[model samples]
Target: MSFSIIFFFVFFVSILFCFSNSDEVYVINTNGTKIIGRKFFTVFEDKPYAAFWKIPYAAPPVGKLRYKPPNPLRWLDKPVYNYSIPYNESCASGRTEDCLYLSIYTPIIKHIFDFPVVVWIHEDAHKHSPDFLIDEEVIVVTISLRTSIFGFLNTGDEFAGGNMGAKDILTALRWIRDNIGHFSGDINKVTVFGSESTAPIVASLLVSAAGEDLFQRVIIQGGSALSPADYRNYNFEIMNKLYWNLDGPFEKFNRTKLYELLSKSSTKKLLVASYDLFDSTEVRDNQRLINSFPLTVELSGKGAFMNKFPLEVYKRKITNNAVEVMIGYTNLDSLHKLDGFVRNRKLLKYLNYNFQYLLPFEGRRDEYGSKLYKKIRRKIMDFYFVNGTVGERSLRRFAKYMSDQVIYPILRQATLHSQVSCNNVYLYRFTYQGSFSLVWNTVLRNLNFSGATSGDEICYQFKCKSLSTAYNAEETSNERLFIKKMARLLGNFAKHGNPTPHSSDDILDGLQWLPLNPAKSVRLLNMGRELKMIKLPEAKRMEFWTQLRNEFFPDRRINDEL
Candidate 1:
């Protein structure tokens, strides 16, 4: 036989062999709609589990449906769904625009019923696998949502009410509520997990009235709605820029014209224009990170995701009040920011001269040279940099400044939630340094950094495909033990709404993670080599931010001014 024929024969045989031991499983929802899944085993532990992949939660948002909220998928005639097909073919022949599917992985252990569910929301869902969480005997889910222009483009009018990404998540949650029970999942025990970019979305959900009673708990990492990059208010101006980039006339470009141009443009054209706009846009000092189409606040609309700023929602006590929360950041979460300063000397020199640019605009976007802005800038430079010079010598200080940009918003959310809500709010800081750190191994490998960076702890929670080989090589190390402990903590939270509900739990080393204390010092759980409960790390820096907020912007507004 030819070499190509031999390879194909071997591949086909291997595929058959993989599924030989597996069996098909069927579930019927409350509406009498039946769906098919498969029972399989984990790669590492060989633990039996069931997976339902490419299950449609909403109709495909294609053509005119682009930039619009997801429409709930209708199951007419109680159709029987065979979702065991290949991933690409199941998602409408692998079209990106028609990829609104969710995959569920549940433990099939004997006599085990109603496993707690964890719905993971992230931009890159392909990199994650349910191997580790499934071994923990929990039902894990990952959903794909619209992103970039399709997800977040806001025309500030009814045509494109904005925040389609958030709307997609809410829709998926509603679907889970109606159908997850058939998959042996406890809908009441749902916990939404968001890491990095998705963290802000979860934060927004926590404060949006439309998200009430959707999920009972949330775990946020490395991002928050309080961050400047969380939302955009200049909707019309940004839409005009996008339209002009597409070769459309900018004159008289109202929301109607903008909507017409966007809806008629091909996906390829929209994607190219979005890429060019994202690439050429200049970063503002107010923005810690630049995102092309961030979430937008809808002042008035039917079924609006967010009708006001998250801060305002918190002040009015009109958000979800009963959901437990676990929020934190890595010790060196923003270490990647140092890579730019290390490579570009001129960028550092300019920042040293114009130090005010380092501080977030907060409520002072147009007040750069104002006395209060200058004073706050001077204080920040004095604390983070000596002699007001930013160079290689101040790299660590710069990292701290950038890290605070991430830490402050997250910590602020925790404290604010604790003050208003009646549920327990747990806080943690991931400080474990190991060979499997995602940000280090991928980008800042040569930096010689000593702590975990942003998204470093996700691999320990899930068996990411890209890092599976490395994880296998270190299967026998202390890191493996740490992974078990982390999983236990998370699983315990999902099961009981508390990480350390029992004092004698050995996997956690009997450490009791205390919740945030609005009346006193903010308690924190440090997830380092030795797991322990301690006072917040860098307490002085947190105090400084608290004092700054009280001194200049006590309102804690999410806009340019209170």
Candidate 2:
């Protein structure tokens, strides 16, 4: 052969060798069958893994299952073989009830090494699709469950119960525990991680007696157990009333008739109805049912809905000593609520109108409410992006409210009840504000901000395209190091029940990660590029908690003096 021909042949062989080395295989679960997943790299050398898109976790909660608890699938004798595409029907254009399938990613292991398992619960106000979190490295798994009407329609009558989605999650976790080992995962070292709305769902598992043993460690990012205000007294009767208003009047609706109506409704109708209701003040309050204490007997009748009360569950199962917990929130989680506003001027006005009507007291009406809303949104954007507050008053107030109502209380209760070591209950507040050009350009529509906001951390840990879009030179380096740190933190927590070795030196320092204290309000984990701890004044923390208790639970106060 000529020298030129030989050189060309050598170059072709080198390229082929590189391509072969880059390919990775994943094994996923479809019903009771298994299928192979092949992942390849894109032109930018970005990793892309495509498995069957959407799969069902339970039988479609349609027909007889509508408004009732989720029922597991019954196996058939047909030999199951294909895992090439997702098994469930597509989520309507935006959201769907047909989303009941789970995706599994099993990494290739050359040796006999047992890898820890991480199960991710995707976040979308419990209404959107779950395509943003399919990764290849850590055996990423996600499931689609009933949302809105199908998941949480609380009709006091026996026909419709709340928490269908949570029950779906439990079923999925049980599936993982029983079968994940076959995919090279350790059944005992499973860690459940969720972002945004899904975080509370994982917190429910941590506190629920029914779900306590499903996994060993819990990681909640961005969201918490706090419920929306309107749905605090959620019950089947209330749900029936709400449904009747949306669909028709109650006289026209019977339990069986309603179920049939819902069954026939396309998944798109269900999704639209759910989003519509979410926009309503009444529905928002009802959604908050999980956050309050002394849940009415009506709410607890639904088995998994009771899991929403983490404080109550912690009190009852205080001594159940079997799990580890890690909790964190992004600096500008509130910005997630404002992204639509930033992207669309029409949406901003629409949101302002909705929120103004939602607020209980109406002394100042539009002027005060609109101003407050604008200030709050701006503060959220600034803090999350620039890490510099134009003014401290708004952020301080918001932080105080969040801490008093949800974050601080949960941490205090968990610390008080936990029999495990201090390290077992890890807490963090992500403040690493920077910019990801690609992520901003693509997924976020070029909204420039950074430092682990909302579900951003998931992008780092999982090999998903959502995070890849945000890659710039600075972010690329940060992403690689952050991924290693996060994965190690999670893996270590799963292996040994603690986030890290408990020695003083080993504990994260200079980051202001002090122990949680309800009284002094000292523990606030600032997880920015340089972590710091900010101690809320004792008087301020107590005052905020007192105000929240008065507003939400006048009958049960936390003794102002105490």
Candidate 3:
């Protein structure tokens, strides 16, 4: 045979061997439900790993169950679940009532039986596999919960108490606690990790009474339940618009009638009405620093996820006091939000005229035209603008002004956790700008931005095929080095409850990353061109906000009491 023919024969034999070597894996939960899964190779190293995808842990929240807490699944017939294939995409990309499924990936190497588990909760949790992290000899899980109005609509009573999204997450956690061990995962070493928009969920789980003892560690980045944007009352005007769009008598309907109409509406109609309420220029005008679909204080009951606000939960020590926490934020978390101002000069003018919008929602709750409201708004304008107006010239300052709203809440939560929790609180600032800067390149088109944006760190933490096109070439030395560092940092935390714990590794370069000492000062490791421990970045601005909150919005209460 010729040389080409010989090569083809060898390749064909290798393919056959690869297929023959693969095996199907199955696990039986404590409840006696057999779940069938498949084994796959990692993206980079091609090492074998097991994946169980799209396994339902809760009953579908459809029909009468809409807007209610998730119900634990019942295997009435003792069925065998053959979830050998993955879903088409992340559930966040679609609108559905039956989206409460979770996927698990575990290292299947010989002699590795019980690995640390990292439960990932993100809006785009399923867009990419955790192949890279799996290569680090850890088990990874990605979970999906309801989103948009379907997950948060409330009439403020037992029928529709809201926070169904949060309750879904809580149910998923219970499932992991009971079922993860059969898949070679250590339930005690579970670390609940969330990034960007999902950070609030992780933080909320940290403080909720229902979340106690479910997980031992947490990693939250770029969000906090304390952020005004994440936790607030539903916009009543938007609720009214939704009712009107649904063709229901707006305010005249009783709570029971409202619940009946919402639970019975079609998913398409609900989505259209939700979009109608959201797709408008005055969204910011009406909502004013509030998240469009915000997490609410659920009514107290057997299944209440968050009966009290997170601050009160922390104050009263109704939280997991021994759970170690790794929390931080990017330098320019809100940079992409500025893309609108860059395109619309009209918005800049509106911003200047409506300076009160710059204030936190807590400040906005103060009556308009009140003395404190004016003082707070004027103080923010003067501090950020420095005698200038909101325009192209002040874009950088405005980015800081916008990003601070996100960062302050994270810092506040870190401080509170450090003070009250018996375990250590490790905080860091992710400032590394890699080639795949999601916000810098995709959203802003690489407009001379230098810092990392909110979700930029995710590309380094995982091998995402969707983001591969962002790279102009193969991974640069810096990108590889950064990825290794991130894996080591997080993997160390999951296994040993410390990132640098002695730091004999070459990647960390003997960096001893210390935890927060809020009693003295808040120090953080700045992950950047040079990794060094530094005093909090933007100290002056942080102090300004701390003083402002102390003076104007001193206390946070649920129903005006803890």
Candidate 4:
């Protein structure tokens, strides 16, 4: 046989046998409608669980639907056919825009209606495989939705609204409520969780009237609605400028004209245009054109970002009781990101030139630089660095300043707010080092420094093939034990609303994970040779930064003032 024919025949046979040999099937009903699903092996043993993949939860947001709120999944009379969950196709090519899909992985069913659901929401990134926690007896879901310009672009008026991203998440949760039960899952007892960028999205859902009724628990790791400033007042001036720069004729120079041209462009075209304009735009001290772009403010419309500022949402909720919350950050989450900024040999000079980049802008840079900014900077510098230091000392201080100033304040604020409003909050710091060192030293060759950076601990939750290779036959390391142990704790939390199950036969060995105390403490996970709770070391420094941030931004104000 020819080589081409041989290859094609082999590929076809492999695909056919893979699906037919090891597949578990079931039918689920939603509102008298029936849909089919297939089960796959999870981290658990021989007992396999079910999965319904690539299920559409919303109407496609294309053309005029762009920048508008997502409509719920319009069902058809005929039952829909689905295959094993495929790789998330949303933004799959870094361009496709119709990715409003969610997949459910339910544990082996003993009873049809007996399991808590955990919904995963993140921007752009999606986990496409059979999920973890199948053994923990909870259903895990991954939601793939719109993000970037496709989700956030907006006009100040009602013609084009913003925050389509947050709205998409809300739509997904509603779909889950209407349909999750059919898949051997619980709808009312859902825990919504997100890591890094998506944590803000989960945080926004906490205040949402529609979302609040849907989910009961939330887990925010490394981001929050209050700390990262999730939503901002839409700047009409900036909006107009964005359209003007979208490779359209700007000589006519009118918002309406530019907006029409933008609306006509494809999602890919607009995304490309954004990239070009984003780099050229001179960002303010506090924001990046794209990175710090917050969910759009919708003052009088549907799901407005608390009428103006993100802080407004939190300020209003301080008195209102909310759902259970688990919030935390890694020990040195922001350090690696800061490494790129400290390339210049003269560290102090680098700071003088880029201190604005390192810190969130509380006021205009000119106002900040000309006044008390220096005194505050001096205090920070003295704490993190000696008056004169260079090379190794300088590098370590740079990392510390970035971690202590940029990351910790936000973490402390989120944990404290959750405790006050929700009454139950758990804080943690991921200090596991051994799991990540191999990836850094060999795979990435990042030899400069190593510790728990942002998103480092996520490998434990997702079945990462590369990380798994770190443990082959005959290797029992602390990292492996911690991963399994922590997974049990987190999975137990999803199953029982508490990581340490109260049942006498506690699966997690009765690990007593205490909640955040008056001191705003955190339960340290994999800290050096020990895993225990510690009073968050940065609380004092965080308190100082929080006061400083409030003085400049002001909880009542929408924008910063000198």
Q: Is candidate 1 or 2 superior in TM-score?
A: 1
lDDT of 3 at 389: 71
What is the C-alpha lDDT profile of model 1 across 402-452, one tens digit per residue?
A: 888788878877888888888999999998878668777777776765778
Worst 10 residues of 4 by lDDT: 280-289
Clashing pairs in 3: none
Q: What is the RMSD, in Å, between candidate 2 and the native fold over all Cα? A: 9.9
All candidates: CA RMSD (Å): 5.8, 9.9, 6.8, 6.0
**Tens digits of lDDT, candidate 3, 414-449:** 888888889999999988886756566678674666
Residue 449, candidate 3: C-alpha displacement in angstroms: 1.8
Model 1 stretches with alpha carbons more than 4 Å out? 1-34, 76-79, 86-95, 248-256, 276-282, 285-290, 343-350, 354-356, 367-373, 474-476, 554-562
- Give TM per candidate: 0.88, 0.68, 0.88, 0.84
* Model 2 CA lDDT for position 413: 37
Clashing pairs in 4: none
**Local accuracy of candidate 2 as per-residue lDDT tens digits, 380-427:** 334322343323223333333333334444444344434333335666
Residue 232 lDDT in candidate 4: 59
Which pairs clash inside model 1? none
